[model samples]
Target: MKANKETKRLFVGGLGQAISETDLQIQFSRFGEVSDVEIITRKDDQGNPQKIFAYINIKVAEEDLKKCMSVLNKTKWKGGTLQIQLAKESFLHRLAQEREEAKSKKEKSTTGNTNVSEKMGGIDFQMKAVPGTEVPGHKNWVVSKFGRVLPVLHLKNQHKRKISFVICFSE
Candidate 1:
């Protein structure tokens, strides 16, 4: 990934299961000012453990991302391998993608339910959202809210459909 004045963080994925944040910092700190490290985890199709992924935030000039990646790529940690690259886009981009996926899933489920109910004559599925929650409207919201936040919000499966909204302050 191309790194420049606009980029300050990189996402490191395909990590060995045993690697930790401290280990990442130790390995990556040599290039420049290392700020934060985060590991991404999720279950596989069979619900088995999966390789860990991470996002590393650096506090140096953007020019350093390449140097850092060069030093980190093909490096080994905790008996496992490492894949480092400048994070693509911002955290909001990820969140927006997740929201779209959830929306599509919901639509498909509704369609399937309708077809089944027509055939079985007695099947119903209800989905509801709690009160006072803001459902995300568009992908831009993610970029607006999390683009600058170093540790972008983790858009897990559960929060995808809840919508994006902010609580306004009243004086």
Candidate 2:
């Protein structure tokens, strides 16, 4: 029996944050064989972690892809809604190109500023304190602070050091 195009592998996208590869495989497996699954992540301006999306590839006839879409489109998973559709060859190609472009952009930004600059609201500090000095603590500071107290290193075996502190703040 010849395989139907509908049963061929199709790509699914617009995944929610809580969706996992295993969840996708299990969910889609009910309709057809899931060949592969991938979740995408990206960082925001503040260097915070963020989930971009996900893709699922199911092995089924072409008609099955449509069926899958109809069944799964606008579905909710783990409190997140999804946008499912048949992935055309051109769509996959476009995704690959976009990924490459994103990678290149990241590389360029790392090597040199790529005009993707964002203002950082706060500052970071590394301080070395004397033995007797007490670091003043601030309340309700504009920026969040994280500090570590460490033994200060002695220079030329001269003076005794108390602590070395490192602090970071976010505005």
Candidate 3:
């Protein structure tokens, strides 16, 4: 996929399973400032071994990155031909997108409870603040997939209700 404009992190796939982060970082440092390198590892249950992939965060000057990518793409490292490109939107960014989609779906599903609170930890909470009421209405009420209304403890006047985290079930 084409890199987003602000993307400076490179995704290094086709990595030899034995390759380490330090080796990857050292190899890519020649192109620009190597700010960070992350190697993701997950336990392969069937294989019973760690499967690894790497992401490198480089801080090359804006124009220099294109040059770096042009020269380094398809280069070999650690016994594997490298397939590199700018990293996609991060996990947190993806979470925000999910939250927005959930919010829109929630609005359509309910009586247009169009009062979701600002994002906290990339999660948009339910907002029950009435327009003119002296007491804050509710915060973070949970609604279930099967239409079970679980009331979470949103402590302002301390509504004594236990609720599950609200989420949109429809895709």
Q: Kindly indicate the candidate among 1 and 3 with the higher lDDT.
A: 3
Error of 1 at 91 (Å): 3.5
The TM-score leader among the candidates is: 3
What are the RMSD figures for all models against the true structure? 17.8, 17.1, 11.7
Worst lDDT run of 10 residues, candidate 2, spans 139-148
Instruction: Evaluate model 3: give its TM-score.
Output: 0.50
lDDT of 3 by residue, 44-118 (tens): 767654556788888776566778777767887676677888888687667677668876775666454333332
| TM-score: the better of candidates 1 and 3 | 3
Candidate 2 off by > 4 Å:
1-11, 49-51, 88-171
Instruction: Kindly state the number of residue pairs that clash in model 1.
Output: 6
TM-score ranking of the models: 3, 1, 2
* Whole-model lDDT values for every prediction: 0.59, 0.55, 0.62
lDDT, model 1, position 14: 74
Q: Which candidate leads in lDDT?
A: 3
Candidate 1 C-alpha lDDT tens digits along 81-159: 6787777766566668766775576467754465422343322222333333223332221222322101123333675
Model 2 C-alpha RMSD vs. true structure (Å) is 17.1
Q: Quote each prediction's TM-score.
A: 0.46, 0.44, 0.50
